[model samples]
Target chain A: MFYDRDPWKEQSMKSRTSLKDVAREAGVSTATISRHLNGSLDLPEPTRMRIEAAVSKLRYHPNPHARRLSLGKSDTIALILPDIANPFFAKLAAAIEKAAERHSSMVLLHATFNKSDREMAALERAAQNQVDGVIFITNRAPEAKVARALNDFARAVILDEDVPGGKVPRVLCDNGLGGVLAGQHLRAAGHRHVAYFGGGADLHSTQTRLEGLRSGLAQNGEPAYEPTLFVGDHSPTSGRILAEEFLRNADQETAIFSGSDELTVGILEVFHERKIKVPDDFSLISFDDARSLHLFAPAITSVRQPVDQLGERAVEILFSDAWDQPDFKALTERMPVELVERSSVAMPANKKKRPEKQL
Target chain B: MFYDRDPWKEQSMKSRTSLKDVAREAGVSTATISRHLNGSLDLPEPTRMRIEAAVSKLRYHPNPHARRLSLGKSDTIALILPDIANPFFAKLAAAIEKAAERHSSMVLLHATFNKSDREMAALERAAQNQVDGVIFITNRAPEAKVARALNDFARAVILDEDVPGGKVPRVLCDNGLGGVLAGQHLRAAGHRHVAYFGGGADLHSTQTRLEGLRSGLAQNGEPAYEPTLFVGDHSPTSGRILAEEFLRNADQETAIFSGSDELTVGILEVFHERKIKVPDDFSLISFDDARSLHLFAPAITSVRQPVDQLGERAVEILFSDAWDQPDFKALTERMPVELVERSSVAMPANKKKRPEKQL
Candidate 1:
């Protein structure tokens, strides 16, 4: 009704024939014509030629917009990610694209760069576009307003990290398990004092992983000391700054647990420039083995996020019909993470030559 | 006319008030209300509150799809790229997103994975979506059909590698200069016998770079044998296979000119595994310094592809008002490339210990 006076629609209607007309011209079902044009159908040579002839004669332009408008779904999902340049997010996007293809859905990318305003703007655009669903990812503590906006979506999935107040299905890597694996490995290597380089301290992932680290550190016995916290955003620049801070302030820390490969890159850059060797000057374990860590100078020890699984599961959850169930909206699925052992983890330099002290 | 009997339209129309109704209720211009909702305009507190109240009271939903359909243009651009997992493409996507934001356009990402069918599918979808424009990027030499499909778009800009039959304006990095730089650097270091690892032999970029390499290598004299060619897709796996083939068959080559950082990564993996030392056993230089080449094991030397400039120029060309000009579609702009010297190149092993013989 609103488009009754629209000039563009008037012009388009006068020029192009509809899918129904083409189907009738070809003496075939409308679904067949639609599928053939969509490149999703395998028609016989004669039938294909007939449909082609009908399309050409009738000037039937296949506009998915009209069909999607009528269906009340655009068959697209908005992927609002933090930073695409980060190898981790890049890998995640690639995996999501592959998985989304299985659902015959397209992904509209919105890079928020971890800025609050950009995040809100992306959400508004997604709403305006009438995307069928949204997958929201953030690297910092999002504002409550962001969560409220997310809650408005009929189908939204909070991915990779948490948004405090959003009531939506979440698919995230097991941060707790990742921390425990790092802590247990560090503890076994005789590392008593350690530093944790991570994103903002208020983030759900940061807090959860910290708690897991403490539990694992105490599993063997009373820990020598509480792991020190070095807070910053999950970015290479932040990592470089954090590494400088750690190097300047650290007194007895024998090892470090990095929150992401992004931070690890920064730390390594500073270390390489300063001639500080991993597992020699300080044993280190990084999370998010999404980068080519195996090829780094001293092959890195890292907690490998199941990036493909995490991405695939998020799409699977978003498209599931079970969203109507009361509990589906409250679901939070944590995929497991694995510890990849390489040369980065080793006996603490201070303890390598010394015998165990008597209790 | 097609939607006169559409049931979904009837339902939406009955439940939701039009933008005009909201504007009337708020006693403001429709443009003002629309801009406010888009978050592109700042209004006085009272005016904003009034518009918000009217939106809430009337339950007016701002559907960009409907507005776009009526306007005959969606404020979105389709980015058809080869692969997103590759750091080069990932960086390109990020830059394009930032640039598209300046134009208030969203980017719809479609990863073709260098598949012809997927490329055509993405192009068709872009047409069906009525996107404002398209930025098509491919790594390989595309088939003629792809070019024909691209030509059908009202606004399309070819980016990165060349498509043989594409008539649209193109934004590409200076591949010939990239080759010349690598070739000159190797020649200066006394690497007369070098191998070129590239993508398809038919690719415009690959061939141009190879030609430049030959010129650069022959700048001193034409005594050395012609450079050997090892061709495959621009992928790490392909690089590994090519490297293996080179190692198995090579005799005189003492240096390598790699086509991409992706290929360089694979070569390093195989070299690291085989205990072949860079600049010691062989010299190397890579193209597309999009990855973290500076932090690799040996700090690889590379030819940087000016990724940001390339992406920004593509978007700029796509949105340019020069499309009406007869010569606009024939435009092909090549951004300059820069060579970043690190520790990859060295003199040939045999020549390292001996002085050059007098002619």
Candidate 2:
């Protein structure tokens, strides 16, 4: 016991008063005082006023350190995002920061770059620091380790994409609706055959979006052959690779509905180089209007996810007091998506000129 | 009498082996040991190794709190940026974070949204926390108070276009060269009556770029009318406003040299709405090729700032030991800019038809 003395609990110094003192003075129990301060309990008006007066008179400051020591948590939230260098993520971070500020809490910022190692480090730091809640954002679907680390949180929220194994609260844009919007717009322009270029084939977002696109296009034409599925990461490099594959395969698809802006960038580059043209050789509709699509040469039509709104709402959900409920941590909120019809989609050229090409 | 009364200087009831003990064993002075651990000394290899071995054998671990008490600075750096959501700034932050990690330091992030009050708060917190250095980034021109607060830092660097008024070191892209490159490209494409749409007119970047634009254009012919200047803060909203103004007052300008990708987004939107075709209606050149301009419909011609290089170099400068040199803090590094030519700039359409309109 020689070195086991508690340095912080020494009796020689004056200590901050506890809730018990206020409770005793107000002639109520400590439970009522704690619950009332947290705004969790609905006490009668006179009782609440008496407790408030007692707290004021006692100069109760409620030691933040002590509170943290007891609950193993702080009044701070964290946002772990992928590729802060991407404009979409950057805008999302800004939205989260603003919402966190409104909640009177500070935010711990971590950019994961979609790397498992970095994601682990961020989560480890958040766990070690006992952050109140964590909002996890990753461009690619994560490994099981990521989900495990995320599941370790007292409170966590999956944002923008689905984490297959986690039982955490989630806030996401409507991936299905986004795909449907893109498909409907492209189809209206007389495109019957389509291609779905997306992120990882196994990712929840990719799967959901592909299904939606199929459903959306199914109504507009004859019993269709399944849209060509091109699987790659949602990145410009991958987009280029997929586009090269699409061109070499001699596809019948007249239009492409890309999963994200990163993919669209790559596809456009390859198309430009091979002398392939948008709406002329192939139509393109990109998801994530986060980039300035209107500035593109053809002014791209896109499925516009409410990026700012998604970010803001994710933060709000993370900081909400509903975490104490058994079902709250398992809640999911899906924000809506919209279609931005620009110049990218046009009536499929040569559709009637060479009907055989349509098949 | 009330407290420990600066107990650091006094040898209390403990082992008598002090830092002096290590010095004596290593045959070096105590001052040398202090300097070596503080990372302020440059000792020869063998001597440094001998001192380190002696200290390790003695089981001497310097008290972190004692070191902090002596140094009057913490192992932290402050990074203030206009918008954390900007891709450029996010990449900059990542680079800064990586560099800070190498130095065993942490970064404190603050988003000012180009506001003065937030800047003041950020600077005050950095000062109160005794952070080692600060890197400030801003979009709009800041007030004198912001500059004064930045100057108060023990070490500070003005990053990007954030703060030109600070007396501290600066790391920025070569905006003048960027403008010069754009102007030259436009001139070669036979565009003379060029209009400039950009960020704040009061910004040093804007003024220098304008001067360079004039100089570059003058190389081809007599100095033209002061390139029609439309000023706004660097944002898409401002860009839209500037575009509207340009359309309303487009006298005879057949080409536009936009200052940033942000402003170009708004300008392109307006053109698309008005059914004004690029290169067919007016040629254009853009600055800050950080965005995916090559994927645009017409494929934009742009001046590419060494964005990654600029970020890495800024971090290198921030942590460099050059701070102790004379006139060190007043250092300014202008990283070079490169031009990426695409299809956006071409022969001005109206010039051939109506040369008299150019006058």
Candidate 3:
């Protein structure tokens, strides 16, 4: 039979030896054996030997799920993110995985692709598996149910972008500062009107970035006009769509504050196909400098998120011992982000044109 | 007790009910209960009802490990790849994860980062977890022990690159074809002499690609000279070092065939820093068009691996019913690749210069 070749057969058969049998053979209470097996208790050498001998005699392989039940820890963390194919999330996940390894924990990855249903399904699966902690990341403004599902976990951390109603510690890049930097750079480059290409209008990151952009563009006084908004999801395909729209509706906007490198790639593709030159035609600043942007045609200017730190800190909070502290869930950490000025941003082509009214 | 506030406490207490207790209450054999619970048995309605009633009465929650033990299936697959942060591997993983999801299986990810010890550790962990299948991927040529460990799995598929002595189905891109495509493209552009930037000299890809390059350059006649080799691990840093070496020893080689986009990025960085223009100072072609090469300054020409198909096929092989067929383990499927002709390649500037004696 094909099943006969299964290597796990013998192991499964051995695992049939019950904990009760081992306890009975060791002449100890079930609690003692359970606690000792999970390394939650200290036992004398003689007692430890007896339990070990009994386990060996019976060939008892403690079931991982039962051990999890007894210990209330799974040694596994669920990393729920938008997409693994995206370089930004992929790098973040790598950092989290490395950090989790240091804590002797494994990461169960679930890619939601920014869909609500998928997000909920991932959460349900994580809960079913009883992971010790969860690191939740989303690009769009999640629904209330998403927040509730996140809150259900005893140990959860919101990462990258915010989930408005989630009652959990958050590890995020300073999105506002990223916007401020982009705004200051563009304004300094003699751009009076700029376009903000974002993932979603309702997203916390989008709003926060917009707020910071306005402050930065104020330039110690009121600016001529607010930046125009062109919103789409963070995928490259969305970037293409937004770029087409921006090109068609171009009035006086000379610079773009892209929410992510993903969008910048798409925008650049469109611009390349149309023979539109960057900087000379439109200055662009991308956030989340996760890709090899420095090697691009014009060498893109970007706001570099502390991606490694953001990921490591998220895992750190997940495995931290301070979960029980008062108001611990209320904590929010905004890791610093820096602007990498490359060759993308430049002066507006038509300096004589007045700034258009804000949309 | 801190454990009192544990959210899983109530669930854990209920899960203490044993399978034997449910079997006894239902007046059935333990094997029958196990088979029925695992959906491996067809029972009468009354019998199924009695078992369900007893389970509900006992508040029994079947341990996932015990269920796996009874069924000889974990509904999990382990993906052992070099690095999750690398875009190529990350995209491949995303495709694998999506495909595995269609089969109702979960993925357990372990990033070895091209380290032998970590590779062995990941394999050991997968074995301990009793994953139903494994998809192993490594950048460098692995040790014999690594191949042996991979062979130990009943269902394992070697992916992306070859692992010599591995007795399992392999799903890989046709490296020879990729090389031939790159060579022909460069040769067509009037490039008699070329430099091949490779990851490792011992890697199967390197050897196969070099062979194809020779034949392609021959083009039904003896080539002017064989392509010189500058080897380094597939990384941007390696690209930079190789670029420096190429510049130092360069004679009449006006074109380069980079083994991966990773190396191409590094090469570009060095070229940019040194003010050496691509297709102007040096023509270039890259393999693994996994990055956004089209957006680069001079869009890079590349051989595009069917990355998504390779990943999907690996998972398909892992779950296929063909594992028991004769010669199935000896199967190797090499997916085709295509040359994406962009702006990277150009005619040699000093066509009159005699090809320097093959380095």
Candidate 4:
């Protein structure tokens, strides 16, 4: 196969000079040369100069594979996310890659698609490759084993959402605040009853956002009613399914807070098909405004995550010198999010009297 | 400091068995064992069983680094792309990653962001890593040196846009066909004078699409007018600039064939800001329906690239056994594109007679 004669093999064969050759010419042990080259040893000036001259004379370059083996570092970070095709995650990956580059590191991407087995496999592979660190992003609430696997890494940052038992620092958008903003906006627009469409009820973001929604809906000392919950994965398909259920079982709910733009797309698709008007029949607000929501049919109202900042901060935290600090691993950095007001939200429709039941 | 004690290093230290250990135990040469493990050597059943038993008894595991050095294959593919943040590229990458996984190969992503230096650097890094193959994707026309660097790879598949000097298999959507579809759609709607928004005039896609557009616009028994070209990089910002330029220089062009949805977003933004209506003021058609175009304010008419097929085919070719064939390197696979009709196109507006020259 052509791969058998690859440049690495050809170069190795063409250039026969090895560390032993340099050591022989420098009149030093191979160990000394290896240690010196890897910066693990400090030799006298004359000896160092002799080794350098011999290395230059031989034109010997250290094998990267061997160097990696010795150093136990790959100069790479692994980005484990749900799906790379998802615009939100794609944008996040781009930002993480850019930030990793600034630190002279490359990113190895793994799209688990929010699957547990895939997540475990990706983590194991990252460990096997001895990556410098990992930035883990999962949409679903992960199993304990997944958290354990993540914790096994020397450095890993849980990003976008939380992992229940993950000991690593987390960088996430303020989901509660996002919910609060959405709730306040809905309440101000004269919406009292609303539904929260979430990925999973157990997800930290979902719980926080729901809590914030309740708090924000409370107006002028009135007791806040818990918004109805519709749980599904953070996908457009799930959005479609949830939207259907919402329509079929809607009970005076006048607004909805979609968990992600992905779901929002699904909801809108069904609505558009069914001729359900937005802000008239139902007001909506989506999270993770990563898509071109501004160009949507009615110009979607959304709670915008600081995606760029979240990704950048995750990488920064992974590579930070403060990893050795006692509280660093337990730290959680919640970047702020803001509500983008567009034409999607409006006052609820006029109440209609219900007819008496007839069998 | 934590990197130095990575689990791989710890494991390596705990298990000192090498290929030599297994070879000695099996009474076979190291080369035989290596070749057997790599599936390069066919051995009798007894010998194979003996080797397996020896390996298990000695608990010998091949060092991935050493194995890579010996085989000259990294079991990894490098995907060099312009940008991952772009939906088109992101979708393409997702498909490629999924396909590559089927072949038990991992993808190392490199986002060059359409820079010559970055392209060169990524290629060099891929070479250094001894990747099994490379899938190169660029938006702009690359310099000859970049092509040369790409050519140096044992196997590379030029994807999406063309690299003129690259001597490798290519997998790209039929840009000319896409243009023709758009042009025909517009021409049918009574748009004789049209404009093209391209990434760059020198780009292969741009030239091919322009050619197709000209052909499509020239219907039977009708004269064809060359569409005015507004060139810019495939970005929303560029779209905005080009739209402004098109407006400033508007003569009689009644429609636009935007190169990509990225550009379409920018044009729409500018048009929205200026209170211009699509299909009312000017008909429009966008290329690369990777974004959620269906939900756009006025669902955009676009040419859809077979992104999934393009990505899957690229990986299939990369790993195919046909490399030894003489014609394989010269292969160019052009996936067909389809025009997705929506409400964005309409008949040209009735012309208002210009005021008689009073000057």
Candidate 5:
């Protein structure tokens, strides 16, 4: 209850000259003064001098927390992600940091390591801190409780993957398009039977991408077989386990579409240890080319997420004034994905091993 | 001055039944209760029950910020680093976060991008927030003003590289040993004329490692040539520029010792684009094997920094009770490094190209 009203807000309000007071004395909009103080704007010399004079007269030091107190903001954003060790999330954090700095906001990081309890704990802490906004990223299919907590924030954005029950603005890469690109690439290379490796079977990304893969494989209304699904968490350990299982149970799968680079690392490690050569033994494609995939032993081809754009857009949405609109909180923006072609994908060696009509 | 005394601390103290009250009721030390509440200690059944009973009777909820007020601490640590997008720093942050959680503390991240002004700003912000501790990391040789600012904190750590005048505990990788390993490896491969690509000419790491390289190269009283030095910041862009300069001005250098993996990425990019081959055109070794070096195009050899150990130790020292000791503030811990042998190092192809007895 001590955090219900930020204690700093109450103390600073009674002592400091507020931003509203400064704006009134300077005969300018509070927005203009804020933008100028944050070094995000340039005004006419006369206007700037007038604001400076007003600031000097009032002894109004624009401490970010104190200034933002008048606006009921924290000047901080809580960034909750599955793991920062993952290159994708690290890059996302960097972009978000850069974007937030432009608006004079700092990021507080909470790494949940894909645990449900940790996710809830981080959300609660964010709420207690009264952060101005929140950016939630999860690799797993989160529980409805997690979504409900996220919805309680004044401003929150779901990023990278989907949270099924969340009624907040969402920014995600086009996973369906990523799957279509992979399916078409594999199909063009004379591969019919493929395996889809995904993080979670119940995840929105996994389902959407799977449907798109089915559509892609069924070129010109031809009979399309559902690709074999291998479900695991988006981690290297899970990838290793799934790779081993796939190797043992293989019947006619010729190529593999890995859900993430984390899994690809595990699959590659297993392949290298067991002397199973990529493309020579099985053609492979990876998603989220956040790592230096181009420098890998066999320059991997991957679906590259627009990481910078996604991060910048998420922060932009969090700070945007459009939140007052009726449907703004329900908005979902999907960024485009691109395929980076390299040596990892090739014509499958077992092109002729499978029968044409196996039905 | 607003944060001179934490406002939350004041508010929480007046309203809540303190940890001291619980300790008094349970007939146990505050330390025991603190550790128990953080779930860091296992207690005997009777003692645990008594503590639980006392907690319930007093309605003493151990909210982290409120509970820590009694101990004159914040349940937060400020992690200031150069860049989070870099794999080495990202991995370091992950380790620090894991270690902090063991003691029920949270990490607040500040990425400075190796800028002096930003570093000072982050430190000032940490002081304002009255964080429990600070972990400062900078890649280049920092200004003296930066060191002075760091010295103001009661519990601050200098990590990775040195701050010239900071009177505080430090935790860094053994740069000398890393250089020795690289030098010895190259010497055994019959390379005498080597190049050292360093982050900065005046950086403590660069100087220490350069001395070690000289000593290692002079094996068994043999004459050691002063290796060529290519000075640049630890970044891919800088690496590319330095690599170009090294190539253009090479006289007899047959190998390179890169400062960090960030530089290696840039050098490798340049090499790949220029059709130069690792260990063929030039043998090379990189520092900070944080990236997937074993899976590189040539499987790069690198001196591996003990990143996890360094992070864990920094946090441990920050929370350690040794701070009251007279000499504790001057303590410095250097973690060991090892060379990861891979395909990147080989006997130089220009073995016979250099003239013997050039002097």
Candidate 6:
């Protein structure tokens, strides 16, 4: 692919077919052709046809950079997402685009699939093209290189997950609050022994959520064993493997607090094949609530991260006046989380003797 | 919003700003300034900065046509997806971009959200920008207006779902085979009574899948009863409503074939809430196994539409020789679907056994 040594990009940049070809074919001054084509003037049939014919024959398309250079403001915004196929990111992008439409800004979407290289590439592209703004979403904590690339952008928002060293304001659901909700729900259902499935042990969101989960469980005032942690990539495949590992080393964990819907899917699949039943053999609570957890066989209990709110707030922050603020890029705001109770949680038969804590 | 109407746009139409400013600032002959600014020649150093300062101060961006008069192709493709937030569409967009990247083409992305207005807006914008090609996707069957807009493009590929009157080549999954596979699986599971939870009754995919269902069921020489149709929008909310309706009227139905994973989610929620046991109370099958359905509580059995393949194929079709055919717009091709057996289906218990028929 690199075989195309187009070193001519810097010099012979005007060498294909000129609009003069179109003007000549259209039988008009280049001015008439330009103005008429641009909707500044209404030309009669024959002239319009001539211009259209020339344009079609030459396959002429104006360079966006030239268009932008002329317009003084770009008409497009670049959206960087961790994974487009993830329901959460997808919904977030959808919300952002809808909001952007109000501003008449077109979106140039790039899915990084949670890869650093892709994120950097997307940022570089956005910078070179001079997009109006950028909405960046990443799952894992990015490296310094990613942060450095992101810092070059005058307007960018860190969304959903984290970019540890990024110098941009972030929009994130209160992950710790989500953890507490899940933990409390499980504890109230009479679960003392529990386990957690999260993305990465070192992630800010994961750690905060973990702290909240422990707090929620402790509210019962019972000295339960330390909750087991199964940290991995936030994907169904990872969830499956983790769930399998948990099952193989079966213990007294009566309830499980899964970090995200992605993980829940994997865990559920493993338990299904193994003939383990939720709220019967074991209860489960999931986070993010991005997927259709309610439609699952057990109607999974979930901590609902205000995804739409996060997305909207991200756009708001991206377009905010804080870019000039000395402390703007260093700020991290946490939106609250709520739990949508469903049937996935249940009291362990052994723990039925213990009083159920009311929510 | 429209306040910034360039007043000079109506005057003389040639000068956006007075050339007097450029000449005065550059401290050079107006001829030299005009020549330099219009790419007519290169200017000396001090003169260049003086010109640059004037250009920067006035925010003088050139007209695109003026630039087009100098350059050639934009080398950009406009990709219009029904919903960018949809994982399937997002994945499709990703694949198309990856392919286009190899061709050194950039993509102009748009998310229509299945709205006719947005679709029209996107189409018009793509047309106005003179995009090299377009790849269109929509869930609802589009109208003649959409077809006309799509037709206006030199190259367009209708992807995933259908646009009935759109005169563009399409690449889609074999809905018929998917439905047939579902029918066959349900039949094998000892279910004579089934319901097709479909997206829309008017959709081409719905009809094709229905026909395939009939054919698949017909294989046993049983001349099975035509499957019941539960029509609704594809959203999970619609799925829930459909599920409620199904529960209210269902008496003989033993299994359900969901149109998409989204609908299946709604159905699952209602069933789970009602404490309905899948495969035991009613077997279930889903289409577009884009989500981790295998991670569902019962590990849902489903007719897996090759979503990745669908995305890649659409891109290929957008650039394929098939589009060269004069009759390409009239072409309808169905990619095959496969059935992934899981725990969602089970033999009917205490069921009035249907008379066994030889195929």
DockQ for all models: 0.42, 0.15, 0.38, 0.41, 0.23, 0.20
The DockQ ranking, best first, is 1, 4, 3, 5, 6, 2
> What's the lDDT for residue B224 in model 5?
84
Better of 3 and 6 by DockQ: 3
* Native-referenced Cα lDDT, model 3: 0.87
Residue pairs in candidate 5 whose N, alpha carbon or C atoms collide under 3 angstroms: none
TM-score of chain B of each: 0.86, 0.79, 0.88, 0.88, 0.83, 0.77
For each candidate, what TM-score against the reference?
0.89, 0.77, 0.89, 0.89, 0.84, 0.76
What does candidate 4's lDDT look like per residue over B1-359, in tens digits?
33334534334221468888889999999999999998789999999999999988885656666666666667678999989999999999899988988876778889998999999999878776767889999989999998888777768999999999999899999999988898888988988788999999999999999999988988885657889999999999999999999999988788999999999999999999999999899999999999999999899999999999999999999988788788998999999999999889998877643332221
What digit string (tens of lDDT, one per residue) describes model 6 on residues B287-333? 88877676677788888777777766666665555554578767666
Off by over 4 Å in 3: A1-7, A10-37, A41-70, A351-359, B1-7, B10-37, B41-63, B351-355
Task: Report per-candidate TM-score of chain A alone.
Answer: 0.86, 0.78, 0.88, 0.87, 0.83, 0.79
Model 4: colliding residue pairs: none
Summing lDDT over every window of 10 consecutive residues in candidate 3 chain A, give the lowest-scoring window.
Answer: A1-10
Instruction: Please provide, for model 2 over A7-41, each residue's C-alpha lDDT reduced to its tens digit, 9 standing for 90 to 100.
Output: 22321111246678888999999888876775558
Stretch of 10 with least lDDT, candidate 2 chain B: B1-10
Per-residue lDDT for B300 in model 6? 84
- Each predicted model: what fraction of the native A–B Cα contacts (within 8 Å) does it retain? 0.51, 0.30, 0.42, 0.42, 0.32, 0.32
- Writing each residue's lDDT as its tens digit, candidate 1 over B102-173 gives 888889899999999999999888876767788999988889999988887778999999988998899999
- What C-alpha lDDT, on a 0 to 100 scale, does residue A37 get in candidate 4? 89
Top candidate on DockQ is 1
Q: Per-residue lDDT of A1-359 in model 4, one digit per residue for the tens? A: 43434544433331467899999999999999999988789999999999999988986767667777787667788899999999999999999999998887888878898899999988877765667889999999999999988887778999999999999899989999998899999999988889999999999999999999998998787867679999999999999999999999987788999999999999999999999999888999999999999999899999999999999999999878787678999999999999999999998877543442321
After best superposition, candidate 6 residue A248: deviation in angstroms?
A: 5.5
lDDT-wise, the better of 1 and 4 is 4
Candidate 4 chain B, poorest ten consecutive residues by summed lDDT: B5-14
Weakest 10 consecutive residues of candidate 2 chain A by summed lDDT? A1-10
Per-residue error (Å), model 4, residue B175: 0.7
Per-residue lDDT tens digits for candidate 5, residues A1-359, read 11222223322232267779999999999999998886668999999999999888886656533433344355678999999999989999999999988877788889999999999999877765656689999999999999988887768999999998899999999999998998888888877788999999999999988887877777888956779999999888988999999999977888899999999988888888898888888989999999999889788999999999999999999888777679998999999999999888887885456665564
